[model samples]
Target chain A: TQLLEQSPQFLSIQEGENLTVYCNSSSVFSSLQWYRQEPGEGPVLLVTVVTGGEVKKLKRLTFQFGDARKDSSLHITAAQPGDTGLYLCAGVVLQGGSEKLVFGKGTKLTVNP
Target chain B: DAMVIQNPRYQVTQFGKPVTLSCSQTLNHNVMYWYQQKSSQAPKLLFHYYDKDFNNEADTPDNFQSRRPNTSFCFLDIRSPGLGDAAMYLCATSREKRTGGTDTQYFGPGTRLTVL
Candidate 1:
């Protein structure tokens, strides 16, 4: 089975601190996506990285896909209390013409005020 | 705004009882997915509907069933509620098949199911 290993399952940081989360996998993926989920809510899409070594930025968040397409990272700059949430990484894999998403256990981030 | 919607944000059911979770989408997407999320764990895909086709995950239990009556709506039916079945049920939608690429999924707030 394909699996994604996400480091730092839980993290707590003071507001304005910078932090980074990593997601790694042994199997190569065609694409990877980042999602943020708040309590009592479903996950919201943050970004999708397709090309290897591609980088995308949304506000203070930067997402990067490894050049080998087997890993990814998310960096938050100057995190705020509002940035507290569960961050998940999901990779898309194609098998026999069917595509499925393999997700990491996720990193729960707490940005304290 | 166009979005995915789930009904009965919270549901309570007794063991051995059956429950159904409903999801609707106004995004007019061609694909819909159901996921079960336990505390601090990743969302596990139970199944999905691509247009009228139903695709179930190989490891998904037979007790879990789904139906997509139309493009706008889908349903998840739990034949018997065990304590392990208690979790957040998330519904998501996407425009097309990923194939060898990625398709962004929009998710609903999710329904919290409690099995007593």
Candidate 2:
């Protein structure tokens, strides 16, 4: 079974538009991470939120950990063509001990210029 | 300089044949991970090594194996490849989990494996 689920498997919008991608789970996580991957490349770590209700911002991208620790969201303000890629959400369970990373299906965003 | 590097960005293997993917890191991180990602799907963890110790996820297939002979190098060995095993394999490096921010992974460009 998939531990995490991301909404809007794919999205395409004109440049300068705002978009929010969500990650949801039925289980609570100790920490969650966001990654962006370009074609033919590995995913790059964008941000990580460890505490429930924690929020982190990177440039125009804002990341928020759900108050319940069971969900998180990535909001990109004024999306640009550069923002086009696959966005993935992964979480580490509190159980800890080199366990497998639980990943969401991911969202593919295409910001057309 | 590349922090993480995987040899043969593209690999083709015959079904039922054995194949090995190699990853080396310049970051000298202590943890190395192997993940498989299909088109538009989440990257799934195959296994990982922390130093010389190997940890396998319960659901991973027995055909997949990994070895980390040293801190900077890790290897993924597929005992028997199948058509379903065709996917992009990503290698990632991370410092020990206790190192906070370093625990965030740095990934290689990934090797796309084609199993015929």
Chain A (alone) TM-scores for all candidate structures: 0.97, 0.94
Complex DockQ, candidate 2? 0.64
User: Which regions of candidate 2 are displaced past 4 Å?
Assistant: B100-102
- Name every residue pair that clashes in candidate 2: none
* Candidates' C-alpha lDDT: 0.93, 0.89
| Model 1 C-alpha lDDT per residue in residues A1-113, reported as the tens digit of each score | 88999989999999999999999999899999999999999999899999999999999999999999999999999999999999999998886666678889999999999
lDDT of 2: 0.89
Model 1 lDDT tens row, B2-89? 9899998999999999999999999999999999999978899999988998998999999999999999999999999899999999
The CA-based lDDT of model 1 is what? 0.93
- Choose the strongest candidate by DockQ: 1
Give the docking tier of candidate 2.
Answer: medium
Clashes of each: 0, 0
